[model samples]
Target chain A: MSESNEEKKDEIQLIFGDKRLDGRRFDELRNIKIEAGILKRADGSCYLEMGKNIVVAAVYGPREVHPRHLQNPSKAVIRYRYNMAPFSVEERKRPGPDRRSVEISKVSREALEAVIMKELFPRSGIDIFVEVLQADAGSRTACLNAASVALVDAGVPMKGMITSVAVAKADGVMVLDPMKEEDNYGEADIPFAFLIRGGKIESIALLQMDGRVTKDELREAFKLAKKGAMEIYKLQKEAIMKKYISESVENG
Target chain B: MRPIVLPGDLVATNPKVAGFGTYVENGKVYSKILGLLDKTETSVRIIPLKGRYIPSVGDVVIGIVREVSANGWNVDIYSPYQAFLPLSENPEFKPNKKPNEVLSIGDAIIAKVLNIDPKMKVTLTMKDKVCRSIRFGRIVFINPARVPRVIGKKGSMVKLLKSELGIQIIVGQNGLIWISGDRKKVSIGEEAIYVIEEEAHTDGLTDRITEFIKRRKSDVGIE
Candidate 1:
């Protein structure tokens, strides 16, 4: 084997010391923590942490759309943005949206378009801002998850909460919730989001893939991703209710 | 505590009329958003916990004048779009002076929402009101969501404060509160309002506020 190839193999091995890194089973997801209503200025806001990834999302509007031309006469428009902090990654990322972030932002809006009740407010806009403070592997998924919670927190009418999880094929096994190490060395990575209602997948909001996998592996990956996303769906509800219900009971 | 319902939660059926924040489908009433379920004798609706103020006709709002134009004065009503207050609509407004002379930027006004255009431009009117401008009084801003509770059912909470403290209070639907009257009473009114805003969602809040005002009235010796 070439020397660099040998070194890369060793590094991958070191990162995944056990059969699975972080002592998690291949299908196990990382610990997720979610908090809503963290920002006083924002209409609604949430802070989300998934393993090492940290993201905050704020929702504004369903208010008037500025720049009058962007106004949709029949439905509210979405101004969705995804931004990464300079210190979010291993190497400091630039503070603004890059190619990856732009793509994520576009897809994130598209994903939200499915969840938000656009017909309710015509000629208005709902702006969602997702700011990543720290990034591990599934930062995009984490942001999507956090933004969904923020949308709910902002009291935007929706069909259901959206949850996202990444599935990857590492070695010969398909795994759920890939961390940074697995993300870099995995054979194939599939990130998908589901709008969940009552333990059922209402719809797939986002589906994106990188690398190669068999058709069978693709289906299995989606199944695993859906299962992982369901867990996140529960967490999202818990986070919202933790803020909403408690405030009512304690203060109302 | 009212049971909270999320979007798509089955709330009721044909017997119960679906109200605001709820929709009916296939003989079932489902919540279209996340909020506390409030049921009345003939209807069921959900009261949202947090959100931007979606302007509607007849909502009394507090607005800041943002721009004075030849036709109308543009006001920021704490909503996404700027609400337009026409100089023609205000009975007291005089075209005899420039728009700025009538209402300048940074001046607050207690106005009512006259109409909302399909384009989402809110048209405000200050006509037919005893007080037009919020002059020489303190305006306290709170979450618009809590405004309804602060006023209480049928304005009982606000009425109690007004009678007890002998103050002029205007509660705006957009979460802007105008307090006036005697100088000492205004301060006491402000504190009582702050208390109401803080504990808007608390149970027995009206009684608690009454007790608070009673204590404050005793301390301040306001007759």
Candidate 2:
């Protein structure tokens, strides 16, 4: 028997049988690649790719804070700018800091500030620039990941690294790392950034959500996101360490 | 070789005092930077592999005079903080002489960090015997964190380079190495310093540097 017209019309098959539209399981994440110390001019730099999202982060300072007035007597201020290239999206995004970019920049700065030992460099500033050359669904999370790696690569003191990922509900099914199309049509999207210490989540640096999910569904999504973050954290470490390891080999 | 550690890695447990580049938390010591874990008898520290120079009292740094004010000179030590060389602290200060006469803009001086206030104002002085102005030399820059390795154990690596290349080198705490000698030897010295900076973490660096100098001399058909 065929389903009713109303039910058939409302149902979108984001999940085909057991696999998602991209032939991935609900718990699968997009392929991620991270590299550190790519920019010689920057104090530290990282280049990362998550699915179709490409992010590059450059860190400068614990240096003097300019404009004089921005100097904080008790701690260094983090100046973060999140920018998307004009050609990043399907339609050319306008250049400069749009409302969404400014908000993301602020939140990402605050997220990194939680782990950074800013008090060590009082009256100074740390400038972090995350540029998205390609944008997909979870560009914000990807930016945070790259920024943290760059900060560490710069040898900035921090209590821990920040790992970020998103979990979404597509077609009534919870999925990890929603792709672009799924994010556009997803029922709920929740992104999280965690500071892990001693193999445990020491704190949640960022938490944001769009759309709706049940209380139980939110908890499940957080667990799923944490798993994805842990995996990404390992990659971040590998990327940072690879710089030194390769140098040793090549020079030897 | 010591194990490489990242930020948040547990470096030591209780009873081991946390030293530089590390912090103590809940009776355990953890690294606060990306570096190599250094464990001593009574303390655990992390030697950072790369970073900007942080000024402290007693560090001899190579600073370029950026501005010459009436009372003092503003020096750029390549650190985040702006360093000042007061006229009185410059050993050559005379009541009748102006600060610019003693050290004008663009002069490079080897000075000691006299003091660093809580606000990060670095005060430098040319009062020490080793402090002087650079008249002629080439400065090679490296990561400040690798300064200790270039210095080696009690000046052994420096001695090797000096004796082998027949060049004069002054390793700055701020990572600006000054090399002065025959033009060819000076350039070779600069390259050797970079090799040391690049492979700072590895062992037997002294031997490798000696071999490198030999190879370079032969390649250039110099002694």
Candidate 3:
């Protein structure tokens, strides 16, 4: 099991100067686009494209809390469903929520709860559904971005938005926003989500470790992930603003 | 259509009063929401164009009865929390009758927000004519954010839909729309509401919507 990753790592270090498969720099990321309010029926919706990964997210509720017992008497309960389409990857994924999907959904819900004012709505549920339509890697991070956009579009009063990025260690190199190949061969894969607070991030909403890593590597990865997430965050905000503020203003 | 600002983006660089959506950080005022920057000589704020309905005191909302309790009824007001309608608030309410008898589950009523407690429990009063039961017509839901567009500048767009098409419409602030009329005309009204929902972000939408409605009505062989 470990031998294959080691072999792939050696070959990666020997051939690629930058440790990225598509000739991107170690810190470089793929193109990102976020479209707000795309779904016609959903209360709030967003479509986010990151590199080769496309994720669509929709938000409904603050509506009725179904399954009467799940209702929280003091705050709005958040529910999340993260799914990958059957054709989202190389192998056709099965059509239901698997263990991985369930875990991501739970984690994403917790991360989002930090930004939302749950106390404002009592005994209700706000549901977030994020579907990964296409995946190359970093589906969870893409899902997080799309979900945050959808929440804002739904007009959920959030303290601030959350943005995420994946950082990996390929051999001795620290990389940001790793693609599929880098993720498989990397020594460590850490995904980080930061809460945008007071115009700066002072806290982490979600953190996960997938492989073996040391202390220094974790620190460097955290620093790099923060930088990467900020870049993505700026674009997300711009996309939302453009959707609401700009006119096609082209008819001069 | 003003300048946009994001969370942590600098909204005020000089000495100024920070308003609702701004917080001072390291000598500069930063926005807390992805909002439009509203600047004045003495004060500045960022008005968020996005978000769900946060019920405040005195807001009129369309509520659907979700649960009936012993003393009052639980109402879904399109907020994350439910609102409570106690028998005491409605002076005309008959107390001995069961809650369902007064307001059945799934009944829609217009109510004034009486109070929002510290825990966010909402109290509603069905004392206004607008807060009465929605007896007839179909309800259409749209994004709460797009309501201003549906209502139009000075109630122009909706009034146009009502007068021209001859339909009764109630524009609920909570994103509930009650459209009442015969089937043919109600269908036309429903289409118009969807049209508004779809292209609400575009500028000069009032004229575009009016033109579309006229063409649609003509196509259907109705004046």
Docking class of 3: acceptable
Error of 3 at B73 (Å): 4.4
lDDT of the candidates, in the order given: 0.83, 0.88, 0.81
Question: Candidate 1 or 3, higher DockQ?
Answer: 1
Error at A40, model 1, angstroms = 1.7
The TM-scores, chain A only, for the candidates as listed are 0.92, 0.93, 0.92
lDDT per residue (tens digit) for residues B39-58 in model 1: 77789998877677778999
Q: Write the per-residue lDDT of candidate 3 for residues B24-125, one digit (tens) a residue.
A: 656777676655677888889765566667788988788898998878888888866678999777655785776678788999887889898776778999
Clash pairs, candidate 1, are A251-B201, A251-B202, A252-B201, A252-B202, A252-B203
Residue-by-residue lDDT tens digits, candidate 2, A50-71: 9999999999998999999999
What CAPRI-style quality would you assign to candidate 1? medium
Give TM-scores of the second chain, every candidate: 0.90, 0.94, 0.85
Q: Tell me how candidate 2 scores on lDDT.
A: 0.88
Model 3 CA deviation exceeding 4 Å by range: A1-15, A85-103, A196-203, A212-223, A245-252, B13-35, B42-48, B66-74, B87-107, B137-140, B148-170, B178-223
Chain A TM-score for model 2, please?
A: 0.93
True contacts kept of 2: 0.57
Best by DockQ: 2
lDDT of 1 by residue, A10-90 (tens): 446412433476778777889999999999888889999999999999998877777889988889999999999999888
| DockQ value of candidate 1 | 0.52
